[model samples]
Target chain A: MSWQLGIEHLRDLARGAAILGTGGGGDPLIGRLLVEQAIREHGPVTVVDPDELADDAFVIPTAQMGAPTVIVEKIPRGSEPVGALRALEKHLGRHADATMPIECGGINSMIPLLVAARTGLPVVDADGMGRAFPELQMETFSVYGVPGSPMAIAGEHDETVVIDTGTDNKQMEWLARGITIRLGGVAHIAEYSMTGAEVKRTAVPRTLSLGLSIGRAVREARAVHADPVEAIRDALAPTLYSHLRVLFRGKVVDVERRTLEGFARGRARFTSYDGTSELELRFQNENLVAEVDGEVVCTVPDLICVLEGDTAEPITTEGLRYGQRVTVVGISTPALMRTPEALAVFGPSCFGLDVEFNPVEDRAETPAGVATSLAP
Target chain B: MSWQLGIEHLRDLARGAAILGTGGGGDPLIGRLLVEQAIREHGPVTVVDPDELADDAFVIPTAQMGAPTVIVEKIPRGSEPVGALRALEKHLGRHADATMPIECGGINSMIPLLVAARTGLPVVDADGMGRAFPELQMETFSVYGVPGSPMAIAGEHDETVVIDTGTDNKQMEWLARGITIRLGGVAHIAEYSMTGAEVKRTAVPRTLSLGLSIGRAVREARAVHADPVEAIRDALAPTLYSHLRVLFRGKVVDVERRTLEGFARGRARFTSYDGTSELELRFQNENLVAEVDGEVVCTVPDLICVLEGDTAEPITTEGLRYGQRVTVVGISTPALMRTPEALAVFGPSCFGLDVEFNPVEDRAETPAGVATSLAP
Candidate 1:
């Protein structure tokens, strides 16, 4: 089903997308404001179902690429994403029938909305990554046979670079990452241009609506004095991310973070309230692994999200700070994302983690593996 | 005002270009071999004068951009320059009427020949830099108001990146440099696409012919047992570059070179045979400053070329080594390149040198300033 996403829907969408961002995907509040401003100026955008599009319809996925920490300070010039889209359209000599999110997480989920709002093009309700990954090759679109090249990246001053050839998606990411650093550590990109059929086959479907539902559930639960953490679990119960669990309830004790090679890379350690247990989360932009006392509890392609202890609000990697009371959650990724092919692209080993791919459900089933209590 | 460049002309062109390279521009022998291979397969390329072009003729300048040190080891695939040219043509949606050299030095001079030999496009007998400068922005084309982008860069594996927008030439260079490093240390580029009128007004005219004359002079002088260094001076007597002098004749004692940020950078120290003085040549790809006994004798936007003491063969920075018998030559740049606007772009300070850009003639006028003798 298609829906009209007006200014009113932005807050919930941002909240839900932040949760899905895991820890990366840039700052949600900044993205929300940018989207709100764009929509306010250009009017509401239509969120279309991927299935409703013709096979010949051209769809372009657009997002931001850089260290989330840099994006926090280097606010996008708002026109960068639209400029990138237009540049790509000009390069391909085709008008995009719809714009979609490359990744349905944090600011990336909102970038397409901003582009759609500004260009008056409907946004397809799907994304390459249902949850964020650090590099471009990690996308399901690439894993499922979409070329990342013929991609356009735009900087704040309207500088546009179109990468027309890459041996593979990894090379494309390498080239784009280098350019992004030169473009002031952040750039808006329009890439993975696909036909409607490819979008229907490769994209994670209905992610925008899913983000909105997750956001609304948390908001409603809060108003009704219900446990927002349980509300989040209920929201994912009927979705592809059906296995959700609270990995830990603790205060952030240490964060060793540094912006490196176009990514925010670091490890954050949390101490449980009883002070006897510890959880360590290592991230490269987004949370990639969660370890309880050095025992792996969850690793990507499973979501390892850090949320506020009481409010259940998503906390991005850049937003993590010492002494903050937090709740860590682990949710299983979609079946398509956990496939052997997909895992090869974004599995724990891809992030240089020593562990193998193990689903969150399997890890959570072990009684001693997780601290599910929500108490701070 | 046009001539055919067959396999016979390549030797002279490469020799002259290496002199003009001012100790940078990659390895001439490697470039010559690549061009020779291409020409043998595709036949000769026509060299057209700037004046011969129709006002609306589409011209693109093609060259290799990276450290000379890297280009020597990496070696081009011979197809990269043409790939870059074709990609840029596609981006612009216009067929190029001709190709030209972005610089009249080293491997860059041969790159356009290779592209033309392959594409059957005539090469304009002109270039952006009469002599080479390390960065893209340090070009007469840019100094005289040509845009550096809508530029295309192609790697060995056929990966192409088109930079369609850069606020200015420096930003274009900065962006291209970052991409070049990611492209495995060397990349071929087609940039500064312009109209024939822009070419006529901005380019350093007939640099290819000038390079040929310099090479022929050195070769003939050597064949006849004449002073090859003096022959080099005579070759530039009537050209736009009228001032020439031997800055030093000595054996290289210490050479410190490292490839950094896509440019070969270091200093070579030369000791006079009498052991009374020392000459230090500091360079970033291309020689930027020549200091004799810690006193500046030459600096950009003039040329500081290093040549074999006996053979007068131009030696690139990457080829510099301790114990090599060498002679440093300083030549005045053309009047157009000495303009305030041009100096601001490539002057001494631009390379972080402390001295002002004094013409080589002024510096050589002081008898104690340079050693003009041919003795080792």
Candidate 2:
């Protein structure tokens, strides 16, 4: 059965998306507001599972491309996503049957729902990345042989660009990011076009529901005065993200960030309240590596999430600031992301890091009540 | 009636385009080779006057966007221009009846011919810019109220982007140049789409024929051992450009160039062979200002052409080198370009220059036997 996403579910979705964001995908506040506004105006958005999609269903994946800092300043015109999709449809000589998130984290997660609300097309429950990724070609769709273009991008200034980079998703991302910079640092893109069958085979299934559950768990825990951190662990325990643990609980002490080639690249350091060991996080739009006391603690595609110590609010990489007390959580990615084909794209080596990727579950000690597998 | 663009004519067109280039538009060598290959493979392209077009005929303008230095290094796949046009046409749901050059100068002139040769469409004898300018919004089409967007850009990597910037051409140029940089420093673009009636009403008519005539004059002058500088003046005097004069005859002494924001911006200084005076040329894609011996000579909206002293070969901005003997010629622009609306866009102030624009014919001393009138 299909489910409708209304205002009641927005908070949970935002929380869940942030958990999956893994410290990237940009902040979801504006995206959540945009989705709420769209849903209110156009009524509730319908979301369908991958199995429910017809064989010939035309699915389009979309997200905002640019630095998170820029996205916060450049609000979309609301019509750009629809305009871009229409332009792409005009180019393809057909209409899309559904929309889907390019990734499950941050703004990308909400953008597809907003697009669905506006276009009246049901959004698929699956996403390209089970978690947020910094680059376009890193998606499971590409690993499964889905071409990134012919893609469509629409700027806030009523400008739309349709890109065709063949199978080279890297080139497409380079070109798209370039346009995004010119569009005042942010632009909406619809790419990774596929049929329902392709989506079912390659996509990370039920990610939408997973994010919602994560968000709801935190919200319910907060209302009942339960531990939100433990709630997150319990929420993801039965899902693809079966392993979860807190890597550090400390105050941010240092951050070094610079916008390079339209990406926010930098590192953040945190120190324990007792002045013990320090944790350093490196990222390019998303946290790529986490080192505690100069030892590698976790690496991508394993999740590295930063949540507020008290409010349990997830903090995006772009939102990292000095002196904020936060808890860093690590979670195991879906089994699909561990395959050789997927690892080559999302592993630490792909990001130019030298360390061999150790699954977060294997690196972290299993808690008293939790059973786990350490096999790679 | 339509006419064929032969190899002989191609040489004249390139030469003429270089003259009109006003030290920008980029080097024409690669563009010439691309067009030659296209013509050789697809047979000669057809050239048609604006008056010959059907009112409803779809006319698309095309050009290569990027720095000349970049174009020299990154060659095209030869199919990108046609591919971009096809993409635009597919988006528009109609085939273009004709092709037009966005400018009459440098590589832009040859790109249309190449596109025409490949698409089997007639090349319009009109252009948006009588001479090249640094930005896309400076076109006569924009001044005359034609929008710049609903345009398509294609990369050599098989990527195409369609833009719609509404009444904002500056944004369009910014976005387009950004895409160009990401496409390995250069990309083919098809923009400023219009109908045949709109083309006739707003386009600088007969720019192709005008460029051809200027080129032929220089070629014939070189062959017959006549004064090439005088030949240029005589050639332009009969067309919409009535007043022409030699601004300086000198050897380049120094050049300062920097690639910034995807444009080759710099200044070139030349001292007369007899060491009597010096001429300074400042450019951004095209020469915008010229000064002789610390006095203003000619500025943008007027042509500041640099030619080989003996051969009358025009030199582009990027090709400027120390010690090259050259003759600088200034030609009055079309009457259409001098309008208040047009001047507001292409004037000196638009380029951040402090000087008020004075028509070249008004500023320059009228030679004996030459009748000139200058009024804005």
Candidate 3:
């Protein structure tokens, strides 16, 4: 099945992407506006489900690479993503039949649509990650054995860099990040070039509609004066996401932010108005660990989202401010992400946390050794 | 007229290139050995004079990019320069008939020969920079109105980044340098792809032979126990280089080295045996300025070379060490580099120094001022 994404779907998609961004992916405010403008100018973009893709279809994933803080200052030129896609197609000596998002996260989730709008190419409704990750190799495509190149990265100045890093996706990221920093802190990339068969095999299907529906549910709940968090839970019940829980509701009392290694990193602390409970969230671009009174409540491979308490607006890691009332939610990731292979790269141990892997839902109830869904 | 670069010529070229490297360009030791090996395996490369080229011949310049300090640690894969040239040729949609050095500094002077050795292509006996400058925009091709792309940069892992920065050569250099750092601190690049006509118009002719002759002179002088510095002077007298002077001879007493912004930078101080006079050499990869007893004696756009006092071996800026006995020499640059456009980008004021630039030859005879021959 396929659908047309008009301005009507932009807000919900952006909203859900922000939630899936896990407090990183950068703020989607500008990206949402840009996609909206592109769609309005170029007409609605067709988004086909991965299953609907022709086996021979050439599908290229596109995203922006850089620090969220730098993106805030540079504000994407809007033409770079499209330019990168075109350049990649030229290098491959073939036209892309469809486009895909490298991941479902903040601004990146919408970048493919911008490219599709300009190129008149349909965007597939699946993504490499069901949610966002900080590095290139963390993508499902790479994790499942697809190469990251031949990839093309383009700058707004008509400058383009087409790279073929062979099988080393880590080196690809290193080179891409280095080039991004020099291109005034941001560059748009079209990588993970694959056939439709390969994409259907490795991609997390239906993430586009999932993000859109999640956003719509939250927005609809707020209209009727209902709890938007509950709306998100209800909306996710039918999806691959298994468990959802509200971990904390408090006012942000402190935020220690620092730009390190080209990423915005630090911790945000929140305390209940009654002063009896406290929660601390530590992050590197994305929220990686969350704890309540020194008890590990949530860790990575699972989602940790911080939202503005009153309106249910998700706050990005870079946008977290001191003294803002917020709610933190924990959601279970897809089963594919909990596999030993995936856990080795993105699990709690990978982040150097002292605790073992415990599902967010069980962590609060058991608080002790519980056999993890992923027992690596 | 065209000649061949044998092992004999390699020694002279390396020596002359070190002198032209102006205390930077990393040490040519490893580069010379690599070239010698390549020549032994593939036979001597044909060196074509720019004026003898066909009007439509494709001339691509090749060089290594990154910190010279890093080059010492991460000796090149030896195939990267050839790979870059091949990739650039593919991108250009035309075969390159010949290779050329981007500059006559450090290892770059020999990289083109390495490419020619493998591809069976001839190397032009000219270069973009009569001497080396740290940035890409400071090249004769750029100064003379040639663009920096479509250029290709290849890494040791077979990772290649082909970029087209249009007329913004500075942006090209920024992107290339950034890529080089990620490529294990070093990469090889082929840029300024041009026609033989452009090479004849813009390239500094005979630099390859100039470096070769300089090296031969120094080696011959040392063989007979004659003054090597005087030999260098005699060798350069027949070329565009106007004046050659032995600026100082002393024992290095103080040396400070620090890696800053990917370049080894600092100052080396030497004092005469009697300690009556002192020489200070300040460098950024390559030596940029030399002062004698608080008086500015040499600056860039002119060559400032340092050699081991006894063996007449050229010492790169990164190789400077305390307690080493050395002699410093200054040589006038080609008139082409003295143009206002070139000086505006490579002169003393461009380096943030307060003093105005004076022709090195005139600086010694007339401390106040003397009219420069190629004044803009």
Candidate 4:
């Protein structure tokens, strides 16, 4: 299916993508405004399903890379992502048939739409990571055999760097990270160029639509005075992230965060309403692991999302505050993202976590008593 | 005029380049070995005068970037310079008519020779810097108006990055420096691509010949048991660096050096043989300032070269050691390099030194008594 993403669809998309960002991928608000302005100037962009593309369609994924905390201050000039795409296209000697998101989370989900709007190219309804991960090589495209090279990065001042080397994806991440830090802790990148067949085979499909669905559900729930958290659970019921649960509901007690090595890294502590139980969340740009009372219940490649207790609006890692009432939710990742190969790239061990990989559903089942405890 | 740079000429070239290196540009011996191996395998490279090139000739300068201290440990794989050259050529969509050294000092003088030998391309006898300076923007090509991008950088593992943007020379240096650090402390770069007319107008002409002359003078002086330091002064008498003076003769008492921000930086303190006065040489890769008895006697864009007291062998900052009997020498930079415009780019204050722009010739004159004091 193909659809048009107008300014009307941006709010829902940003909202949904924020939840999918897993507490990283930069602030969705900035992305929304940038996309809104780009669309207002260039018109709405077409969103094409991955299956609707011809096999030879050239698809390039675009995203912003660096600490989300930095993105809040050093907003991109909006032309950077398009500059990266054009630079890549010039290097490859071909125009891209469509643009896509490297990760269908946070600002990245909005980046492709901005690129598509400006360039009159359609955006594919897919992404490399169905949810966000901090590093470039964490993409499913890389795990499924896509080279991250011939990649182009653009800075706010119109500087463009093209890495056309034979380095493996991990080395690519290291090199790009170093450059991103130099580009004032933020850069726009167009990488993981692929054909339609490669996208169909490797990319997490329908992720854009999934984000929209999730965002719409939250918005609708808020309008009707229903429980937005429950609405989020219902929204994911039919998706790859089918298993969802509210790990904890509490007020944030502390947030120890710093922008380090081009990442928003920190830990947030939450105390239960009665102050009997505590939960701690560790993140590097995106939430990596969550522990309830010092016991691990959720970790990557599962989505650990922090949302406002009442509105269910996603709170990125950088947005976590000292006293905000919030709910920590964990949703199971897609089966393809949990395979041994995928796990080796973005699993708990990769983030230096001592725990082993355990799916959210298995680790924290929807207990009958807990499910009905939510305030309605 | 053109000349063949055979393997036999490398020793003289390296020795002369070391003197011109101003205690930076990496160790000449490493560059010598790399060039020697390349020539032995691929045969001699032809060195051509900048005037020999046609106006349309595409010329690219190549060099190694990073701390000289690191180059001593991480010897290049010998293919990086060529790799950078080829990558730049690919980015420009043209084959280079000739290769040239970005600087006539230290390892850089030999890098272009290696690239030329490997690619069967003739090297221009001119260079951007007649003597070495630490930063990429401190070149005549930049001072006289040549952009640094589209530049190419290549790592030991064949990783190549190309900067193809509108950034000015300083920003290009910053971007390239960040990438070089990530490339494991050392990388090869091909930059300042220009036409033959630009090369002829902007380059410090005949620097390779000057290095050869200085090397020959030192070698012959040593063969006959004469003063090699005086030979260096005599060798430069007819060149643009005509004002050469032996600044101090002393034993190194203290050396403080560290590899920081991809540069070899520190200060070496030398005491007179009789321990009457002290000379402090502050450097960032190449020596930038020489202070004698707390008075600034020499500073960039002049050459502050350190040499063995007896052998007159040029010693890079990385090679400075405690207790070594050394002579500090200052030579005037080219007239073009000392211009107000050039000074603005590479003058004393550029290195964060408090001293004003004073040429080596004006600061220290050759006293008749001091000239006669050299041991015969």
The fraction of correct interface contacts reproduced by each prediction comes to 0.98, 0.88, 0.98, 0.98
Candidate 3 versus truth, CA RMSD in Å, comes to: 4.8
In the order shown, the candidates' Cα RMSDs to the true structure are 1.6, 4.4, 4.8, 1.7
Docking quality of model 1: it rates as: high
Clashing pairs in 2: A160-B162, A161-B162, A162-B160, A162-B161, A162-B162, A164-B159, B24-B285
Question: lDDT per model, in order?
Answer: 0.90, 0.85, 0.84, 0.90
Task: Give lDDT: candidate 1, residue B99.
Answer: 96
DockQ of 3: 0.82
Mark the 10 consecutive residues where model 2 chain A has the least summed lDDT. A367-376
TM-score of each: 0.98, 0.94, 0.95, 0.98
Candidate number that wins on TM-score, 1 or 3: 1
DockQ of each: 0.81, 0.65, 0.82, 0.83
Residue B296 local lDDT, model 3: 85
A-chain TM-score, model 2: 0.95
Residue lDDT tens for model 2, B156-247? 76777777777788888888888887777788888888999999999999998998898899889889898777788899888899988777
Please report how far candidate 2 places residue A38 from its true position, in Å: 3.0
| Model 4 RMSD vs true structure | 1.7
Off by over 4 Å in 2: A364-376, B364-376
Ranking by DockQ: 4, 3, 1, 2
lDDT of 4 by residue, B1-376 (tens): 8989999998998999999999998888888998899999999999999889999999999999988989899989789999999999888899999999999999999999999999999999999999988899999999999998999999988899998657488888998999999998999999999999999999999999999999999999999999898898899999888988888887899999999999999999988766677888899999998888788888999999899988899999999989988878889888999899899999998999889978777775423214445432
lDDT of 1 by residue, B291-368 (tens): 887788889989999899899899988899888888888999999999999999999999998898888888644332
Model 1 Cα lDDT, one tens digit per residue, A144-224: 998988899998888999996653889899999999999989999999999999998999999999999999999999999
